[model samples]
Target: MSNSLFQPITLGHLTLKNRIVMPPMTRSRASQPGDVANELMATYYAQRAGAGLIVSEGTQISPLGKGYAWTPGIYTPAQIAGWRQVTDAVHREGGVMFVQLWHVGRVTNPDNTGGAQPISASAVKAENVKVFVDNGTDAPGFVDVVAPREMTKADIQQVIAEYRQSALNAIEAGFDGIELHAANGYLINQFIDSESNHRTDEYGGSLENRLRFLDEVVGALVNAIGAERVGVRLAPFTTLNGTVDADPQTTYTAAAALLNRHKIVYLHIAEVDWDDAPDTPMTFKQAIRAQFDGVLIYAGRYFTQQDQAAKAELAIASGLADMIGFGRPFVANPDLPVRLAQGFPVATHDPDTLFGGGEKGLTDYPVYQAAK
Candidate 1:
């Protein structure tokens, strides 16, 4: 059977050669002292340019937005110049790339932010959640998240301004588009989830109010970069990082309707992939599609060529999704699209060096070679 995974698709004004996408996965390899992208990061992305579209790892929009150590940021001029190297490398290989703007909200400890308190939609803490941080000691490791201060109206406005500025910075760095990191229980997700948000202001309480932050940020990004060049990611059913909503279907469906009004480029769904993780029902998928009429992307644990190819084909053929994003697969298989298409053997990646590391696991993954 001929699969539609290799077919071309048009997203806004950008035409993707295939449906395979390289979604963002934090490598935590940014340069120290400045937390800026570097030539090593550029080489890593260039090696995986075989994907139809590449979404860079979650990049903090400002110093205060950072949660994990060594992740890249977009606020400083040095950081902007560093990211330019990455964008240039991907473009030289004829690949379209988007930077995922991020703010970790309460998903951090004071150790990671130079003693600054983490802020979120409310003062509530994410129970049992741990964040990787450097305590100015020997090595960096995981630490339990602390309670965050409730964001004031002024704080809210400043974050929105930062998002707008980050969008402009992304353009300055020569990216094809921008993908807001509203998923994975991050800053935006904290506001959207009822369990994490307990405010009575205009930015919380009712469902519409909770979505206000997302709406404002998206509007700002769309205004700065145009709706056609912007995308938003959501994790409706994911409980990762202590995010929980009373009714995910209702909440996320309403979110889809709201985003439909903006007519953004696409909606990327980050499906839960952990072992024994609950499956995303078709009802939710249908509800979201009914409300938002745009390209849809789904990313999860699909790895094998046989399974992923079949899933991708079914998704596009049935109008359920227009693209499929492969995360961990791209970590080991830089030329994953070619390997999947040609039935080549894929390499395994080391989980130990998945986060902060040097060139060993970052750029040393070998491309597929035929057995002689």
Candidate 2:
């Protein structure tokens, strides 16, 4: 039997070496003061360059778009230059990379946004959600998110412009493409999901109105960077960060069809991965494929070299997804593709050192050593 996950595949114009992807995971280790990507970030990504594609951590599009301390931004010239080094390192190791552009919307505290009120499609506050922020101490802390102000026509237009500029900045930084961070109850999710948005204007209430911000931002990105270089990540059945759509199936199917019209490169679905989390129904997967013709990538809990590995292979063999993303597995195994192909045992990452740390848990994980 052919090793389906080890085969080469075409993504946009680039050919990927395998069907394995290293999806975006925030380490919160960017340079202090500027939230810029640095040599450490570069080295971390380069260590995991064995994947077919590498989607970077959530990079805020503007200072005001920030939601966490120590996360990188893509708007400033220094930030762009910082990302260039990271991309150059990834390219040196023959890896394809895409930067995930992000805006937190109401998923932020005032401290993370320079004390400016966070803006969203509506002024509703996220319930029981907290964002990481600098607490005037060496270690950052999490604080409850404040209710965001409703975005005006001008605010919406300005944010769209920022997304366009950030897309251009990613291209200038040498990324193969860009992925809009529309998942995990961020800014875009704030608009697409019904529960968070309470506006009564043209940008709210009806499904189409709620989706208008997403449509406009996507259109701006597609116009700034070619549709072939654009991608969007959606969390269909997740209520993470308090984003629960009244009807997720209908919402996401329509989202897929909308992206299809733009001719974007891919539509990445972030399936709920936590223990006891409900699996995304196969029927919904079929519905998404029916609407979107581009490449599909699914991430979350697809383990390496075990029953889950077989499940990953089955997903590809059955045409459910073109590529499979192994998040936590790749964090501990840099040579993940080789290990997956050889049936090597995967290592566990340190949960204590998962975020806001240096090389200890980030780049210190070693490759699997086979028995001689």
Candidate 3:
């Protein structure tokens, strides 16, 4: 059978050697004191530079955007300098990297935000959701998320400016592009989903109104960076962090149509992967394809080597997706694209050290070595 996963595809100005992507996965391993990116994080990404596109772990756009402890940010000068190390390392290995701009919105605790309350499109709380907070211990585990204050118009405009600034910061850090973290019940997703947004303003109520926040942010990013270098991640059917829309199919299909107007480089769909998670319907997929003309990327659980290959082949062959992203698999296998192409065995990841750790599970995963 023909393998399309290894074929080169052009996404706007960047041409990827393969269809495999390293999606953003927060590891919370940034150097402390300011949540700045560090050498260890740079080493971690450089080790996985074989991926066609490496979307860096979700880096907060500003200090107020942070939801978890130790995750890197792109707002500070030190953070930008630190991320430059990561981008330079990746570039040395002939890899293209995009920093993911993120804001947790209501999915945060005051303990994590220096006594400041979290803000979202609405004041609604994400029930039963928990975020990691440092308690000055070896393991600063999960704590209940706090209810957030409704974002005033001023707050919304400020965040838009911050996002634009963050995009500029990403460029200063030497990143090739940037991805907006608008998925999985984060700040942007909070505004997009009706369940979370209860405001009477123009940013809520109707679908178009709810999408206003996303439109403004994307527009700002496109203005800061070019549209060719910007991408947005969306989780249409995901209930993660209590983000759910009344009509996901209608909502996301409309979203895809709106994004087409901006002519972004790509639209990354974070399909549900958990056990018993709902599968994305074929009709919905077709709707997205019909509406958006840019590159499409899908990420979920493609468990085995065969599964990964088959998914990539089918998606690419059918023109359903331009790229396939593997999250946890990339965590354990830095040279994931090579191992998949060669049918090499993939190592299982350690769940205990998946987040908030040092070299144990971060950069310690060795590349594939042939038996001598």
Q: Highest lDDT among the candidates is held by which one?
A: 3
TM-scores for all candidates: the values are: 0.97, 0.98, 0.98
> lDDT of all predictions, in order shown?
0.90, 0.90, 0.91
Which residue pairs show collisions in model 1?
none
Q: Once superposed on the true structure, which residue ranges of model 1 sit more than 4 Å away at CA?
A: 135-139, 305-308
What TM-score number comes out for model 1?
A: 0.97
lDDT of 1 by residue, 1-372 (tens): 355788899999999999899999998889888889999999999999889899999999987798888889999999999999999999999899999999999998887788899999999999999988765642469899999999999999999999999999999999999999999899999999999999998988999999999999999999999999999999999988898999999999999998989999999999998868887999998888889998899998666555645666677788888899988889988999998888777777888878886888889999998889
lDDT of 3 by residue, 262-320 (tens): 99999999999986777799899899999999999999875555555676678778998
Q: What C-alpha lDDT, on a 0 to 100 scale, does residue 85 get in candidate 3?
A: 91
Measured with C-alpha atoms, the lDDT of residue 220 in candidate 2 is: 97
